[model samples]
Target chain A: MLGPHAPVATPEQLAAAREAREAYRGGLVAPTSGVAHGLVQANLIAVPRDWAFETLLFAQRNPKSCPVLEVVEPSADGRVEPRLAPGADLRTDIPAYRVWRDGELVEEVADATAAWAEQPLVAFLIGCSFTFEAGLADAGIPIRHQELGTNVPMYRTARQCEPAGRLSGELVVSMRPIPADRVADAVAISGRFPAVHGAPVHIGDPGSLGIADLGAPDFGDAPEVREGEVPVFWACGVTPQAAIMASRPPFAITHAPGHMMVLDVPDAAYAA
Target chain B: MLGPHAPVATPEQLAAAREAREAYRGGLVAPTSGVAHGLVQANLIAVPRDWAFETLLFAQRNPKSCPVLEVVEPSADGRVEPRLAPGADLRTDIPAYRVWRDGELVEEVADATAAWAEQPLVAFLIGCSFTFEAGLADAGIPIRHQELGTNVPMYRTARQCEPAGRLSGELVVSMRPIPADRVADAVAISGRFPAVHGAPVHIGDPGSLGIADLGAPDFGDAPEVREGEVPVFWACGVTPQAAIMASRPPFAITHAPGHMMVLDVPDAAYAA
Candidate 1:
């Protein structure tokens, strides 16, 4: 999960990710990421059409974290357009998936073809932290997840996202340790990309966000806070997914954490 | 209808207008310009609660003209709260009102109180053109309606508003002929206040908006195209009203054209 890739490995890795997904359809590679490169990855949220507008409104109100990329319309015949990727079935495109029943994820899935239906459900594509980490590195900012060779650290905060209809919940944010001098630069760099989680919500104190300890993140790996550094927090896209879990409609689907749907749009488009 | 107060009226005239509305619950003081200086005036629309979200989304999608100032929650006792003024009822608040049935104007009433009910419905307060025209004069931009003592010219355009759900229509704009040299200054002046129709949508060429003649507008009076002056169009708040007329819900209520609910908030708040 951690290591710099060869210059050619970027493309090679993306190819391998696609190949893995293909083999995933045939039962090969069991996880995504560590494989894709140059391709824009996305968080996936699938819900019935009846609740599409409320969910969409939730994304709009909590834009910093839940910046939507594309909304794939389910075809009249109950199939996600092959546009997510050619010859790809949403039910089987990723290495892993999670199925939620009445708001609680009941089972992890390898494929959901049997679950695909004629119901007018919608699929939403959201930008992810991985997309921003690429930009941070380009700006000479260090990312903690890459350093630890583990998942990025995320926590539920005291901050609540703007509520819309039935969609409401506390915000979840991801943290990265930043050098004291580079904090401003990191903020300025990320602020330019409003489509992604633009800028830091909190810069210095984890307690200010009701986060008890830096050592205990609600999700992913714990980060090392250096002597002269501070932990910076950015609104995490997972906030909406969490809200969906709480609002639990009859049926909903999301990518299993790290696995993402690579898109035709480039990361550059995510920039403001 | 045309008098010295046509451009500027005293508070007494506005009070009389309000009193007249309370008397028989009716009055029509054409071109509400200068009528209620400090009182909140509102564009009115009444529709069954079932279609509330579509209309709200329509207004949100077309913010330039339909800048909602407030929303009246659906009542359980058939009474609207936060009434625009004392003894002011949504049923009979405004001086003049138009009623639409199945997308057609069925009646023009002096009061609509008879239709009042605990039925679910939502109301919104949109920014009015009067708010911006006042700011323009403060900035030294003499508006034509004030000088010529006439209503502002409003026209329907070829440009379509972004559609939401059941709402869709071409934009309607108010045209003001400004001194040619002052167009840029006028834009910079008005652009600072986006809440009140913001900047002009087009600077010249009425034909571009699908208007066949400048002498005749779909609404309001035409202006003389003075020498060295150009027609400047601003998004009118009427666009939402027009959309409502097109997609007429079974039941809806709106303020008469010029009779508005004067809000406690000042016009200056509309300034960006």
Candidate 2:
């Protein structure tokens, strides 16, 4: 469904999304940004049923960082089909997947069918900031990372998340430099899409969140904070992956950074 | 943490809330409506760890009816302290508790210490309409049930909720008679608190929702539709209870209707 603020996808945009998903399912590995316009791209995380409760609870407790779009419980036959996309098999659809063993990244694979078949895994499709980034760009706010052709800067803050069961970790945030005058506008635009990481958690000072230096981030490329710009920080989706590492679940799977699962659902579907 | 729209609670109101909670813990049995002027009250549901994931997933899928405020995982000693109220025991804080066995209401108890200790129970504190009702009253919208001194009329609708695991049930809604002129005001006021059941689900016709008689309802009292007034329906918190009955978990616990767990957090804490 299209939202009032989001334009309806053109036929070409729809075809691009469908083709991209087909290519990924066919074992093509590549970054997904800018591949499909006006469609929602999701971060994928799958864990065994034994750890699903804790993972789901952790997301519930820290919704700002983990905005779950859908949770796909394996069927009696142990097949997972995310509701966001019909007839799409999660096992092999994402562009790339990271396999973790005891919280350590063991390998990266283009397809995860074999790993998925090993256990009854519950898959979570979490909202990504790409949806709201479109909203921000539409409102004339400059996204520094996009202009620089680099990854968004992410930092691990000193703020401890509300722990759920055994899963606990520090809050992680992604930073974007917005013009001083457009900071409020950027917040209002992104806040409309709460299902994605909504609104800036911190506006002006990174040090306040225990981020020692904005230039040296824990993940992603350094940001370009031009003159007359303020570094605005939004809760990062990496927070859940950080929890998986901190809590050290026996096994887990996630999409490699920048390699996302494109959904059939429109970006506007997540807008408030 | 006072919200801009919400007024700060006076000393007497704060005292009244504290006293009401203490009285309930000391064996007083009464409805909790109007007991606390500006504090938040919550709906309680405690199910064994076996059924927790399904229940939590059900709430996530059907958020409008079952907005979860906090989930309390039992400690090693089997003690549950809801984060909403520090140092408060869920087993004895509420005015009344209902014990369910295989989806059937087996007994109503004043203190649930025995029932709670029967097994490891994970307690979920869900949002209640009482929080938004304060907003409605503040906006000068009349709440008919309050004037009639009867429970809000609730009905089982034809719409089925999105099933989660073993949980599946029809959507249940509460009805309030609002003057046609102020229906917009009522919706706007309540929509501000999404943590509770937010805006009206239906506005004018009962037949459209598959309700045959306004005089009869599946739960709560029949309504008084005055002249120039329309029946407005909202997703009811009773939905989760209906799902519990439909799905028939082996054992469950809930607060008696209209008897709630009072929390220390201000109502504004939940305001958007």
Give the root-mean-square deviation of each candidate in angstroms: 8.6, 2.9
TM-score of chain A of each: 0.84, 0.90
The model with the greatest lDDT is 2
What local distance difference test score does each model get? 0.67, 0.83
The TM-score leader among the candidates is 2
Q: lDDT by residue for model 2 over B1-272, one digit each (tens)?
A: 12234445567766777788789989998777666866888888999898899888988998888888888877777667876666778989899999999999999999999998888888888888877787787788888888777777888888788888898898888888899999999998888887888887789899999889988988778889999999999887778888888989999999987788888777777777
Q: Which 10-residue window in model 1 chain A sums to the lowest lDDT? A: A1-10
**Tens digits of per-residue lDDT for model 2, A69-93:** 8898777766678767777778888
TM-score, cand. 2: 0.93
Identify the CAPRI category of the predicted complex in candidate 2: acceptable
Interface RMSD of 2: 3.8
List, for all models, the DockQ compared with the true complex: 0.07, 0.42
Clashes of 2: 0
Interface RMSD to the true structure, each candidate = 12.0, 3.8
* CA displacement after TM-score superposition, residue B135 of candidate 1 (Å): 5.3
DockQ for candidate 1, C-alpha atoms: 0.07
